[model samples]
Target: MVLTDTHTHLYYETDAEKQDLLFQRCFENKVNRLFLPNVDVSSIAKIDALVEKYPDNCFAMAGLHPCDVKEDYEILLKEIYQSMAGKKIYAIGEIGIDLYWDKSTLDIQQTAFREQIKWAKAAKLPIVIHCREAFDEVFEILEEEKADDLRGILHCFTGNLEQANHAIALGFYLGIGGVVTYKKAGLDEVLSHISLDNLVLETDSPYLAPVPFRGKPNESSYLVYIAQKVADIYHISIEEVAAITTANSKKIFNV
Candidate 1:
């Protein structure tokens, strides 16, 4: 069973030994493909290097993350946009409003999100949205920019059914991750109403690790646990979850 981790930060690992072990674990778990999202200018080199080294397994995306948005975001975004030229980026992502960290940068974050959406449309690529504590803000921007050509995933979706339906209605897939395994997350109820075709799996790792490994550093290898949780939620088999979500990832990333 081939599994795809639609969002992971393998580039964040600095230790060669641990990185190799992580990749080995991922392969052992049949989580072969990993899509790495860009955070800011500092992440470019590491992202590029990871993709270059594991050209077959790793793919890179270019975008300024919402949390990274600052007063001089214009300059940072310019460099990110320029780097996308003739590059092998899968999407313009991990971008959106992030009020959780700093609400002061909301204006700049929205501007960056709008601009990056334009870039994604111009490049004919999917976008991996990173919405956090700003679904309304993100929806507003998406409403203005929505079109038949626009497509992407709402990475790490943890919203109510109304918001979930809204995102699906906009021709975007909901990216399910480790949070689904949490008992009180209420994601299972949300998943019960959403179709499997409109869903995709992600780890958002070295971040949201599944239960049993919760609060620990996450990895792509743990995607199986998330998939299992999704299967249970849907009353389906883990194999079916793997097949469907992998297909969904391919549909979005075109990889």
Candidate 2:
């Protein structure tokens, strides 16, 4: 069964040996497909190099993360957009409002989010959103910017059923990750009501590791654990979960 980690920061591992080990572990777990999200200008080349090194496994995306938005965000956006000049990007994202980190940057964050949505629309690409403690803010923008091509993944979704339906209505896949494995997270219950068709799997790695490795640094390989948890939620085989979620990822990334 082939699995895909639709949103991961594996490029953060600059150590060559450690990167090889991580990819090896992912291969062993059948998590061979991975997509990298750009957080800031610094992450662009790292993501590019990783994709270049493993062209068959890793893919790239460009966007300024909500938390990274600042006074000079427009300049940052220009730089990020320029980085896509000769690159094959699967999405214009990992972008959206993030109220968890800093409430002060909400305005700029919203601006960045909308701008990136426009970028995606113009390029005919899907977006991979990063929403944290700002569902209303994120939804407001998504609703305003709704269009036939404004579709993507709501990365790291930990919302309730109503919100899930809201996102689905707005054309997005709920990206399930490690949070679903935490007994107290309640994401499993929410996901049980969500169809596999509107869902995708991700690790968001180097963060949110699943149970058996909870509280530890996450990796794409542990995507298997997240996949297994989803399998249990729906009483389906892990292979079925892999096939469905990986297919969902392919639908979004067109890979």
The segments of candidate 1 whose C-alpha lies over 4 angstroms from its true place after superposition are: none
Worst 10 residues of 1 by lDDT: 80-89
**Local error of candidate 2 at 56, Å?**
0.4
- Which tens-of-lDDT digit does each residue in 92-200 have in candidate 2? 8889988888999998898899989999999999998999999999999998999998899999999999999999999999999999999998988888788999999
Local accuracy of candidate 1 as per-residue lDDT tens digits, 19-135: 999999999999999999999998988999898889999999999999999988999999988887777899998899889989988888988999999999998899999999999
What is the lDDT of every predicted structure here? 0.93, 0.93
TM of each candidate vs. truth: 0.98, 0.99
lDDT of 2: 0.93
Residue 107 in candidate 2 has what lDDT? 86
Stretches > 4 Å off in candidate 2: none
Error of 2 at 119 (Å): 0.5
